[model samples]
Target: MATAPVAEAVSLDHRLGDVVVRLEFADDGPVRLVGLVSADAFDASRPPRPRVTPLVELSFAGESHVRHSHGTRHRNYAATSRLRLVERVADARRLSVTQRDPETGLVVVTTIESTTPTTVAIASHVTNEGAGPVAVEYLSSLVLGGFAEAVEADVFRRLRVHTCLMAWTAEYRWRDESLADVGLVDAGIPHPTSSTRTSYSFGALGSWSTGTHFPQGAVQDRESRQLWMWQLEHNGPWNAELDDVGRDVALSLSGPTFRQHHWSQQLLPGESFSSVRAVVAPVVGDVDDGIAALTGHRRAARAAGAVELPVIANDYMNCLMGDPSTEALLPIIERAAAVGARIFVVDAGWYADDAGWWSTVGEWRESRARFPNGLVEVTRRIRDLGMIPGLWLEPEVMGVDSSALGDLPDEAFFRRAGRPVAEQGRYHLDFRHPAVRSRLDAVVDRLVAEHGIGYFKLDYNVNIGEGTDVDASSLGAGLIGHERAYLAWLEAVRERHPGLLLENCASGGMRADPAQLGVTDLQSTSDQEDPVLNAMIACAAPSVIVPEQAAVWSYPQPHYSDDLNDFTMIQSVLTRVHLGGRLDLLSPAQLARVKAALSVHASLESFIPAAVPFWPLGLPGWQDEWLALGLRSGQRSVVAVFRRGGTATVLLPLEGRATILHPIDRGARVSEEPNGLAVTVPATPGAVVLDLIG
Candidate 1:
C-alpha cells in the first residue's frame, strides 16, 4: 500500500451507537486522539466517569498493520488496522462514521489521522446540542495480537481454556478420575490470588484477572471460569501489591459489602459529558520492537539502578512489643542464617530498654543484656553465617529523658514558646538544623565502618507533634521539622549507601506514600496475622510505586481458629513477597509445617514481583469458613480447588482436554484426556500435585 503525504486530505469522523469516534494528527508528526464522552445515565447525584480509547496501535505478523473492523478478534485492531485513522488523520484517505441516539443531540463526529507510516489516531466526539445533560458509557477495546496473552504467558499465567462463556464469577472444583464424573474438577478453582485481591484497589487497572486457564494435558478434565482483566485484582506485575498495603488504596471490600469499581455519572446541564481517554498498549511485544509502540517511552530504566542491599524484617515482635527482650528473637536470627537467612536485622527493643523509653532516639546504643557480646559479635556471627548484617533504628524519635532532646541545648531542637507538641508529649528534632544532619551522618558512617551493615530498616515510631517546647516563632517547622529531619536522613543514607536497599516503616502507613517510597525499597504490608486480613494489606501493596515486598507469615501459628491443614493451605495462597516466619516458636508438627510451606515458598518467592499472576473467582465458601482447599502449579498451568467440610460435590475450573498428575490414596496417578487434565486424589486436606504433561 502506498503512503499518504503530509498534505493529504484527512478523514475526520466515525460513529458507533451513542459514541462518535474522532481522528486527528499532524502532517509531520505521529497521531493524537481525543474522546468526547457520555454516560449511560444522567443524574447529578451520581456522576459517571466516561471511558475512552484514544490511542490504539494494531500489529500483524509481529509488525504494524492498517485495517480494522469491530467483529474480528484477529491481527491488531489498534495499530495495524488497514485504516490509519484513529491517530493518523493526516494520512487517512477517507474516514467517515455516524451514530444516532436520543441522549446525544450532537451528530457523532469521528476524525482519522495518519501522521506517518504505520501511526494513526481515531477520536470520537459528541457535542451536546438538544439535551440539558446526557450520561454515556465509554466503549473502547483493542484487538491486539496475543500481547495480552503473551505478557501473561511471559509472566507465566498460561491457563489453557476450552470454554467460551468462561464463567466470569463462578466457583469450580477438582477432578477425580477414579470416581465416576468426578474427574471434571480441578483442585484449585478460579485462580489462587483472586480470593484476596478483588477486595482492594491500587490505582490502575493493568495485567490483573481471574479464571481457569489450564496448560494442555496438565489436567484432562477441569473446567475453566472467570475470565477478564479485573478478576485478578492486584495492580499488574512487579508491583508492591502487598507490601505498601495501607498507604495507596482507592476502595476496599471485606464482607458482603460490595464496593463499586465505579458506577453511574452526572452530566452538567449544557456541559456535554465528562470523558477519560485511554491508550491501549500491549504489555509484551518484542521489547526491542514494541517499547515505542506500547509505553511511548524508550529504553527501560537502567536494569542495575537500585542499590542492592539485604534488609532486616523486624522490630522483633513488631508493633505489639512493649519490650523486645521478652521475644527471644535474637537466637532466631542466628538460626535463620543457618537455614539460609541472608539479611540479619536487630529489631526495636534493641534500642530503648522498653517501649516507653523509645524516645531515647539520638542516643542509639546497644542495650546491655540483649547483646552481651556487643553489636560487633552479632555482625561477625552474621558474616560467619554468610549473610549481610543489618539493624533497625528510629533516628527521628526523641524521649524526654534521652540525651538528644532532654539534655541537648534548646537551640538544637524544635520548640514553640507556649503551644503543646500536639501528638508527641516529648520534644522533636529539628531536621533542617545543620547539627541534626551531622548527627545522622555520623551514625550511618559509624554503622557502615564498624559493623558492615548491609541494609537499614529506617523506622519512625510516631508523627512528631509541634509543641510549645519549640520556639515556633523563631524555630522553624516545630513538628514538621521532625519530618524534614527524616527526609534529610533519607537523602544522606542514599548518598552514603547508594546500593543499599532501604526499608521504610512509619508506624506502618503514616509515611508510605510516593515521596517516601521513592526513597525506600521495601515496606511492611500490615500488622494482621490472619492471611485474610494480611491479604487486605497485600491488595493495597502495589500502589506504593516501589519494589514489590509483602511481609508473609510463614510459621504455622498456634492460633485459635485454624488447625494445621487449614492454616497450611492458606499460608501457601498468602502473599508471595515475604520474610521467613518464626519456625522456632511453633510445635513439632508446625515445624514440619514450616518445611511444607518452605517448599511452596521456595518456588514462588523469587517471582513474587510477578505477584499473583493468575486468579479467578474461587469456591463460594472460600470467603466463608470452609476448611478444605488446594493449589497446584506445575509445568505450564496451575490447578487449585476448594471444598466444604461436609459438602460432597467439588467443582473444578479446568477447561478443555488435559492430562494430569495427582496424589491418590496408595500413590500417584497420571492420565490423559481430550479436553482437560485427569486426576485422582485421596479425599484429604492437603495438596495434590500434577505436572502438565502430554
Candidate 2:
C-alpha cells in the first residue's frame, strides 16, 4: 500500500519593533499563529508547544462545521479547510501571508504592519476566484486563540475586558468588567445536559457605527500586566466578540455583523473584498501605556510629511448656526484673526438662500442671498486678514431639495431595492459611483481655485442603516466599498491641493474612528455647547484620538462670566483649540481673557505634538467633580485640572515641582507634598493648567 503524502509545513517569524509574530503554515492545511509575544517575553526562555491557532475564522455559502449539544452549528472555513500557500511577502514594516482554498476558489491574504514598536495594524483581503459568486456571511480582521494556558489557570477570572460606550451627547464612556461578569469565564466543567461554551458579543450598527459603542476595546491580564488593545478602523457597521470555548478563548473583530446588521458580501469571480483594518498592540503596562503606544501608532500611520495643527476659529457653536452672511461675518472674521486664529471658518449657511437650507445642501454654490457681493469677497477678506479661508461642507449627503438630487443619476446615491436610501430628508451619496466622486471633486476644486478655500470641515449628520445594495451582493459590502472610494477621493483631492486642511465631523465626534481620523487633519470632539458638560468629552477624547488632532470647542457665550470664559478656554488649550462662540458679542474685558487664553495656546502649540497624555485622576466619569489630564514631554509636563462642583482641594499624584501656568482663579494655589502635588481651587467650579518642571 502506498503511504499518504506527507503534509508540508513551514514556520515563519517576523519582528516589528518589540512585537514578534510567528506563523506556522501547512501546505494545503490550516494556517496558525504559533507565536505572538513581546520582545521581553520572547527573550525569556520558555517551554515551546503548539501555540497554533487559526489565522482567520470565516463562514460562507451556508456551510456548517462544528455542532453543539444545544442544536446549533457554526461554520468557520478557515478552521476546517486545508489552505494552500499561494504567496508570502514581507517588508520592513509589514508581513503578508496569502492562502487559497482549492475547493472553493477563495483566496485570503492577511497582512500585519507595525505602526509602532508595540502596535501592529492588521487587515484581511478576500477574493473569489471561482466561476460563480460567493456569499460571505462572516469575515474577521484579527483572531487569536490558544490563550488557555495563560488565562485558564485563574479560572479566566483575572482577565478583564475594557470598552468605551458612546452616545449622542455622551461619548467615550469606558466600561471595565471581568470575564466572569460578562459570562466569558469558564465555570469548572459543563454538566452533561448543558454546554459550557458561551459567547459575549458587542458591536455598533448603521452609518453611525460608533454612535452607541466605540469600536475600540482592550483585554488585560491583571496578574501578568499583559494588555492587548485593538481599534476597528472603520466608519461603518462593525462588531467585536469574545467567545469562551471551554478549553480555549477566541476573539473576532470584524467590520460588520450578519446577524444584527443585515450585512453580507457577495463576490463574483475575480472580485475581491477587503476588511476594515484594526490596530492591535500588546502593552506590558496599564491602560495608559496602551494609549501611549496607540498614540505613537497614530502618528506613525499618518501621511508622510509635517502636518500643521493650527488654531481654528469657527463662527458656529454659540455664534452663528447656519446663518452666515458677508455683513455679519466680516467683523467676526476680523476679530477672530486678531485673536491669533490662523484659520477662519465661516461654518454653515454660506450656501443657503433661506434659513431652510439644511435640506438644500448638495449644491455647494455660493448663495446669492447670503453673499450679495459674492462669497469670494468674504474669502478674500479672510485672506486680507492673514487667515486661511475655510467653509463647512457636508459632501456625503444630498438634501431632498438639493439641485443635485434631480441632476445626478440614481446610481450615484445609495440605494436599497432599486430606491435611493433617504434619511432625515437627505440621500446618502454612493462614493463607489464615479459620478458622485466627480461631483465632489468639482465642488472642492472650484472652491479652492475660485474662492481661495484652504480648509474644509466635512460633516455627516444622519445614520443610514446597513447600506445600499446596488451593484454589490451585500449591503455591508456596498457600504464598505463606498467608504473606500470616499477615502480614495480624499487622497486624490489632497494630492491636487496639497495645502488644503480637512476636518472630520459627524454630528460631532460620532464618526471619529481611526480610519477617518487618520485621513483628516482635525476632529471635532463634540457639538456640546455647555462648557461644563464638554469637560468630560474633552478629557476622554485623547484616549480615542491624538491630542494634537483633537479639536476641542472653546466657545464662550456672551452671557458667560469670567470664570466660565476661563473654564471654556482652559478646556481648549490642551488640544487643538477650535475657538468659537460670540466673540462679536463679548465685552472687551471678557474678550481680553479670550485673547490671553489664545496667547497661552499659541505658546503651548509647539510642545503639544510631542506630548503623551496621562490621567492623574484616572479616567474621568461622566459627572466627575474633578478631572485631571496631564501631558508629558521630556523634562516638562503640563497638567490641566478642572474642579466642577464637589471638592475644594484635589491631590494629583504627580511627583514634581509645579508652577501655575494659566490659573482660572486667582486664589488657586499649588503646593508640593511628599506624596504628590496638591492643587486647591475655589469651592465653585474652576480650572487651572499647571506646568510641572523637573
lDDT of 1: 0.36
Q: How many clashes (backbone atoms < 3 Å, residues ≥3 apart in a chain or on different chains) does model 2 have?
A: 0
Top model number, TM-score = 2
Could you tell me how far off, in angstroms, the CA of residue 161 lies in candidate 1 after the best superposition? 30
State the lDDT of candidate 1 residue by residue for 179-207, as single tens digits: 11211122232332111112111221111
Candidate 2 on 1-694: residue-level lDDT in tens? Answer: 1112225776666787888787777765667766566665563344434543467666675764443412121224432455667776777778887877777788899888888889898888999987888788777788765444454446377778889988876888888898777776565554321235457778778888678888888888778788787899887888787765554556678887566567778888998878888888887888888888888888888945555567899988888887999889998988888778899998888888888987888999989898999998999999999999999999999898888787689888899998888899899999989888888999999999898999999999999888889887778778888887887888898899988999999988888888888778888888887888898888888888888899999987778777778888989788899998987888888888888887777788778888899899998899899998888899999988998988789889888878888754458889998889999977456788899988
Candidate 2 Cα misplacement greater than 4 A, ranges = 1-13, 24-29, 48-53, 69-93, 146-148, 190-195
Q: What local lDDT score does residue 26 receive in model 1, on the 0 to 100 scale?
A: 35
TM-score of every prediction relative to native: 0.48, 0.94
| Superposed Cα deviation of residue 678, candidate 2 (Å) | 0.6
